[model samples]
Target: MADFKELSRLLEEILEQGPAGCGCAVARNGEILFEEYHGVKDLESGEPITADSVYRQYSTTKVAVCTGAMMLLERGKFLLNDPIYEYFPEWKDTMVAQPEEDGSYRVRPAKRPILIRDCFSMAMGIGYGGTDYTHQAAEKVRAQLRANVGEYTLQQEIKAMAEVPVAFDPGTHWLYGFGHELVAGLIEVVSGKGVGQFLKEELFEPLDMKNTGYHYFGDIRERMVTTYLLKEDGSREASPYFQRDELFEPEAKYEGGGAGLFSTVRDYLALTQMLACGGEYQGRKIMGRKTIDLMRCNQLNEQQLKEFRNPYLEGYGYGCGVRTLMDPSAGVNSSVGEFGWTGMLGSYVSIDPAEKLSLVYMHNLFPNREAYIHPRIRNIVYGVL
Candidate 1:
């Protein structure tokens, strides 16, 4: 067992110096080493955060959704190179890339078809932010989708997605937005079930992740943390998008694959543990070892990895999740080959296969203060080990 006192101390200093709420958990080789929580869930109500507290996982949900998709892949339901249009006819030869101005450069048909591997590589032609021509075109399509369809449902949203122009040819460059959600939709189409239903049957049930799902309900609402956003003055405000009681409701406004799902630290740890164990947990084989191997291996080439690099991610590659490609020599103390991702609300999970280690941090505060906390937490834990 590893001593996590240093990890706890770092987390404490982070809370004292930064925000007022935080939670963290550390697990290794399928066993939890330590878990901690600090501060209030609701400042006004004085509700304290605990191990069971659930928070919106944002993009962290991508890993779960991707894992679920991989299970289907292992079962031989679909091949990685299979054209995405085969699953959804509407996607067939439907992608068109908008080009730079001047009649010489204009929109063109995709050279290759969108495939399952493209989704994993985030090269499926969708992005959240940019001012480039492709990004501008994608944004316009998103706007049109929202305008035509008032909600982001699977059927409705996918129809709208089909209408959007491709930002690049399939399997070309990486862009992160809506690709995972589209994967969820495709799962629904292929499995003849809803995304939530498929996950429940294929993942949550097998892993005994009782509190993990697309939406919380009934008594689970009591343990749900209120989402927050950072105000201009550095104060936190409740997010307008997530109401205090929305978790209890059965009908959700949208099935957001990219930025949805609420889970407790322990629940998410179970999912990550499964990955660390090469897709088996508690004697059940959720996915074959080979499939898990594919997920952890670098899916992007050096050039593609360079294109997706951002300030937040230095030497990294897109594995099933964010993967550190280089050692922490330049900065970032995490081990090379570490793979994981963070949520918009300060939640994070990372798996160091080399060390047989995993770390999970869950929080509800926004304008995420991860930069201040992640390094300290890594240093403390790595130092002890």
Candidate 2:
């Protein structure tokens, strides 16, 4: 058995360092073994963190979006290899950026059309504003996205991506950009419903994830935690770009499947538990066992793995919007087949099928991603186990 006391202590150590607050839970065989909350939700009001505290999910939203895409795949709406141009014909003529000798770039026709699986594997050449350094073509796309973060609709964003050149041919390289956003658009195309609606009907309702959604409502606004940024000198301040008031959008102009959602730790736990249980939670089937099996397995090749560069994901492989434990020794004491992803802010979830365990740690901090938190938590959990 894992040392619940020690695990709590380890988390307390992190909270001691000053991150607004955090909520964490560990489960095995769909039963909560250890769970805790620490610190205050909002420093201004001094409200305590609770199980129902809503958190900005950031990139962790990809997992849920990708899950919905897998459900679409299971329904035979489209094959993995099918050209996505059918849904968004504007992408049919997209180009890859080729560098020129004059410190410029030339746009060239893509060797092949983007495949549906490319989105899941993150092998799609699409990129975001955050990764402008990856390629000149991506820089252009990033610039556009940055300028119009909330102005564009999901479909408009997809169209905008098509206009920008790609860094490489689809499926030839791994680039974690706007692939999940495209996946959300694809889901909309097939399901004939908004991404949020589809998730609510297919996932939240069935899983009883009452506190999970693309936007907040009612008392949820009160419980929403404030996000912060821990400076190099250890002082903390609220993130200017991601304030609580900014999140209160009257309507979601861009339900970015890549990075836009709010969820509670317990609600996220239910989702992870479903994944750990092989697509079933409390007798309700969210997805097939084989589909969950496919997600936990590595989907990247040697070249794709080599090209995937991120310190946090150093020893991981891309699966369906989640990181697969490709090397047990290379990761944070993670066993092989452990699959999950972290939010841009400090939030993580990994379901280890080998141990029949699910772990969720969430906090609202922007610049303070707490690089050591995920691995430390993993080590503590596995150490006690």
Candidate 3:
């Protein structure tokens, strides 16, 4: 058995310092070594956070949608190198933006077609939300998507994203963008089912991850945690996003793959446990062990990994929507084969195949990169063992 007293003390240190609340768990060889929650779920009501408290997973939702797509890959439903245009024809004419010395960018034909692997690896030149001139194109596309959130289907939104000029040529440079959103749409197209339905049938049901979903509703609404923003004064303020009535509704207005989904620490542990167990949980095979190996493998080369941005991804290799540790020194006391990603709201998970260990730490703080929860928790987790 693993003693997590040090880990608990570390979580308490941060909880008292700033964050409104936190939830953490660790599992080894299908056994939970440590699981604990602290602080309040709602500041106003002073509701306590329990294992069942639901959280908006943000980008951490990528692993779930990617896992769904990887199942299709294991079934031989599609080849990774297959051009996405084969499914969404609108992207066949996709263009890339090339920067000039004058601080201007010119649109040109893509060097090559975007492939399914590009989407999974985030090498397709997809981008995230930004407000500067450099990100104007992606932001416009995102704004359009946000404006029509509930109106368009997943496929429709993907097509809209295609209309935006790509940041770079496919496979040239790596950018942590909305590839998972495209993957979510791809899953729907390949599986002949809605994204939510496919996940329910393929993953949530089998793993018994009942509380995980693209949307919140019913009695689960009451269990949803309040979102918070760390203020300049070192205090936290509740984000208005979670205070809305529709936020806790039964269905989502938009099923964004890049950053969507609300889940509990327990449910997410099941998902991680499946990956840690090489795509199986409790005798149920969610995906092939070989396929899981491919997901953990480094998918980028020297040049691509060099260009991979995002401070948290330092010393890691991009692979199928997850970050694989390419060098232990580049990460926080990690094994060379560990892989995982974090959410924008401070939720993070890591699976170390070398050690057969899985860790999940959850919280509700924005500007997650600045929060430093991921590295702190990771260091403590590794320090204990």
In terms of lDDT, the best-performing candidate is: 2
How good is model 2 by TM-score?
0.93
Tens digit per residue, CA lDDT, model 3, 1-385 = 2247877887888876566788999887799989999998988899889998988888888989988899998888888999999988999987887778998888889989999999999888866756534368766766777787645666767877777778888877777787788899889888998888899898998988888887665668788888887777777888876434353355545676787678889898888988988777887878887887888788887888887745777778878889888876665588887898888788899988777788998887766543366787777777767
**Candidate lDDT values, in order:** 0.74, 0.82, 0.81
Question: Model 3: which ten-residue window has the lowest total lDDT?
Answer: 242-251
> Model 1: residues >4 Å from true position, as ranges?
1-3, 101-105, 129-152, 242-248, 321-335
List of clashing residue pairs for candidate 3: none
- Model 2, runs deviating above 4 Å: 130-150, 244-248, 309-311
Tens digit of per-residue lDDT, candidate 1, span 200-319: 898988999899787666567788777777666767777857433453357775665676788888888888888877777877888886777677777787667878777667767787
Off by over 4 Å in 3: 131-135, 138-150, 242-248, 309-311, 369-371
> How many steric clashes does model 2 contain?
1
Which is the winner by lDDT between candidate 2 and candidate 3? 2
Total clashing residue pairs per candidate? 0, 1, 0
Q: What is the C-alpha RMSD of each candidate to the true structure, in Å?
A: 2.9, 2.5, 2.4
What are the per-residue Cα lDDT tens digits for candidate 2 across 1-385?
5577888887778876657789999998888998999888988888999898888898888889888888888999988888889889988886887667886676789899888888878887866554332354455664677687745678876876677777778888887777888899999999999898899999988989898887767677778888888877877787757654454465646687888888999998999999888888987878997988887677788889988746777778888889988777665686888899888788899888777789999997766555678887888888877
